[model samples]
Target: MKQAESVSDFYKRLPSHAPTAVPLDNAGIGHINVFSRETCSVVSPYSRRDFYKVSLIIGTGRIYYADKWIEIDRPALLFSNPFVPYSWEAESAEQSGWYCLFTEEFVQHSERMHNLRDSPLFRIGSNPIFFPDQVQLGELSAIFQKMQAEMASSYPHKYDVLRSYLHLIIHEAMRSNPAEHFAAYSNASSRVSALFLELLERQFPIDSPQVNLKLKTPTDYAGALSVHVNHLNRSVKEITGKTTSAHIAARIVSEAKALLQHTDWNISDIAYSLGFEYASYFTLFFKKHSGISPTQLRGVV
Candidate 1:
């Protein structure tokens, strides 16, 4: 899987995009910023985003939602959460609108996080695109305009004000509707978890008995992702609701079952290929998770 685009990468990838703020603040807590899509460029990656985004598109474009597509020829509100993969393309030469990008910590400590995440607009498998009429577009536009104002303001609590504006925008998306693991690091935990998962899954499906599992432990994943084992454990559990060890073991067990059923490879070879030095160890692990020994499951499965 492709690494999700980070905030910095967002700017870098969209060459035509310019920072709406003078100082160009993509740092600090929450790190929310708004910009106009005056001269838009297509971000055709069609992959996950590292942070959350809410876009008010006033131009014609095609949106790449998870496993689907939405063509926007009217003013539309798109609520993009971190989990789902998405992208957009400007079909017309001229594009106009506003969008805001914010990190997980921006709302992590507040109840609004749940509201935003649980709302239909941002929830996975829900419609993320909404077309609001002229009136609703005005209301949404004003909020974004206000965001630009506040972002350019000298007010001490400008961020607090921006947070409210974000909430207002999210609320309107519904009519209703919209990490961790930091501010400076920009969702270090999630990025680490994603990288770890990528590394783990990359070694999968065991093509041959001669090939050995390269990454078979939490420590291996942690080292590959350049995070501490404890950090990896906490981050994986926090995001996936499963510990690192559990994830590794589950993958191993799954591969073992496939090997036992699909191929005639010896149990010892299967064990060695899955990073278990002893066939007995693999059998014990398989039984623990699958409730049956590898031998018993071989023909039965």
Candidate 2:
């Protein structure tokens, strides 16, 4: 597992010709940046990001989202949110498309602030992949091209114009499959399950040594969300097909692997930050979950 990529790191990884003139705000809100897949540099596998991304990928590729692997056999539209960890692996050498990345605050100035996260494009667990037709692909491509041009221009209201273009791409995707995209939770169980997942993902990346995970068990999460532990467990299991504890453990192991591979922290410090009281107990837990010790993984990486 790789450490999550920050927006600044992403900019540094781009090709020499890729523009970086757009200034990012103090809140880490970047003006919309567009890239052509052919020109952009490739990223490592299992890499996670801290920003939102929308891509129109053409050619063959595989998308790893959460635990699911989605194969792209044709032109497709993909949406990735900050909460979900996803990576793209290209199967074919010939790839071409457009992708734009921006932060949640980039669109906050718009009147449709509340609807941004509520939209299917940014919703976790909702299918973010779509196979678009030739005509639809052309339309989406044109919007991205316009955005690319606008991002390079010094127009006074370029950011505002870019917001409309972003919404256009989103609405176009929603229109492609309104039924699936607009599906809403009609029951309390489903809503609770969504909330639990959101709360669970909020404690992720463990980016700093000072930022320790506070929610380690289902009961801890239920207390935070003001729900019964049993009800939370049942809802998570019913909707996700996995127990709440399984999700928590898997996420912890994932973060542990990232920390072990990417950071210089000692094993004891890493263990304590992850909520383990002792280094020996963390070793036992990590070996049980990953079949390897933290030191072993660090050496391999």
Candidate 3:
């Protein structure tokens, strides 16, 4: 399990089976449905590499993220970039939904569509769910239908057609999205959260000891942000619904897992590198949050 460190690290663990979900043999993209309630209920913890996901709620239930639960009252759009990890908890086997997965390259390569980055839906470091009315949902679904049609059809410019339809979907989403939802985060609490998120993202892909410069404590962040420790925690908790220590620990745990998975470093090396005074202490901390020991994660078990 990857620790939910930076927001990007959170995203990197998003799990989906896009390869088998899509029907095309050489096609790099496709869509599928993930429904859970009884046995396969929990989405668990996983990440994505090259694909981005957009989900439309067709069944009824809750969507969990950001330490809070969002009720999916109606059909709505949920966006997950390649950088986040998300999961669902099930009381039973009663959840269902449609999830669309496509490669960034495919979406960006098709000609004349609005850039995916411009859609406001695909922006990095932001995760705002957009709820649409009946009329708008109908329009958006039409665009998706057209794209699916183009994918299935044998046309000279099928890819181009799909791009055009996708552009329409994005534009409709932009046109219909509630502007205030995006704007509400622009105030004080949001700014602090944004800064913290940026700081968290910068610590990753640490290639060496020099790269692991000590972001040693909460005060290091509070001092840099020019706010009292209490005030920083208050604002962050207000906006994000999690405590400062939780975020910090989460970030450290996230980085620790990434190193364990992607690097050849030993436990002591990783522990000292993350600023732990003792390897045993680091092991305990990692196990507490992630439910597994680092050594076991490295497959030495």
Candidate 4:
């Protein structure tokens, strides 16, 4: 298997030209194109890029992501976040399906769309896989069909129609699978976790272009959170089942993969972009977690 790049790698590759500005071709931003097996099979696990994809399965297949294989059957609703590398393995070569490609901006402009974040099921980090019931399947199919009709229409406000239609399906999916509530926790624990996640995200786009520099250590984050390092560690461990440092490292690693796969930059450029002073240090850090060297992952696709 080829090595996988990190989440940050994709961000670096955000298309220079604003993603195609062409008007809806019978379908708006939420356009659903029925793909052939030959087209679908081209999506490889080693390649990395951002694309909002939803597949309505007509037959059984296996999807590989985040180091796990999820079996997808008929009436299945599978959503993959942009930048997450996924590949399909199906028993039969004659599988068929309607595939939709969209952008995050299309759905994120509304108030109701906030549920996309509250519900971890749709997010990239948390794997949200759903096997819908027959009734639910019919309901979702109707929504897809409605979108197709509106997109094909020449209404002056067709974009709005397309956006609303997409939002309806997203909201319905969120309602079908309610977000899991965490156990009641004291204010301190909750505050600590929230702060940690924020701090972790900020460490990205680091200053160096040759290697990723260690920004905000555990103590650094603890200091910013205004808590003792031990207390911060305890709170993170109790709430997330992982240490503060570990969480930070994971996000950093994910970002590194994103930059590597999506951008045209050389290893040194990528290393420096992530805040590393020396490319070797970043390589060492990545290999420790990903089990492969930076150079080996360049042509992963």
Judging by TM-score against the true structure, name the best candidate: 2
Cα TM-score per model: 0.56, 0.77, 0.53, 0.63
TM-score of candidate 4 on Cα atoms, chains taken together: 0.63
Tens-place lDDT per residue, model 1, 1-301, is 2456787787788755646553334344556778887855655665678788888998898996653578898999888887766668788877899988888877764566645665556655467888888888999999999998998888988877888888887666665322111123348777777667757756755666888899878988888877889999999898889899988887788667656765678999999999989989988888999898888887675
**TM-score (C-alpha) between model 3 and the true structure:** 0.53
Please give the distance, in angstroms, between residue 188's alpha carbon in candidate 1 and its true position after superposition.
Answer: 36
Candidate 4 on 70-137: residue-level lDDT in tens?
87656577777554556667765566555555555555555665445444555545555667778877
Worst 10 residues of 3 by lDDT: 31-40
| Reference-based lDDT, each prediction | 0.76, 0.80, 0.61, 0.61
Model 2 residue 179 distance off true place after TM-score fit, in angstroms: 3.3
Error of 1 at 272 (Å): 18
Question: Which segments of candidate 2 are over 4 A away from where they belong?
Answer: 1-4, 15-21, 26-30, 44-46, 66-69, 113-115, 208-210, 230-243, 253-273, 283-301
Instruction: Write out the backbone clash pairs for model 2.
Output: none
C-alpha RMSD for every candidate: 12.4, 3.9, 8.7, 6.7
Best by lDDT: 2
lDDT at residue 243 of model 3 (Cα atoms): 84
User: Any idea what lDDT model 1 has?
Assistant: 0.76
Q: Model 4 misses residue 137 by how many Å?
A: 1.8
Candidate 3, 119-229: lDDT as tens digits: 467655455477878888787666666665655566866666666665666566667645832565568878887777667655543445324536666678788888787
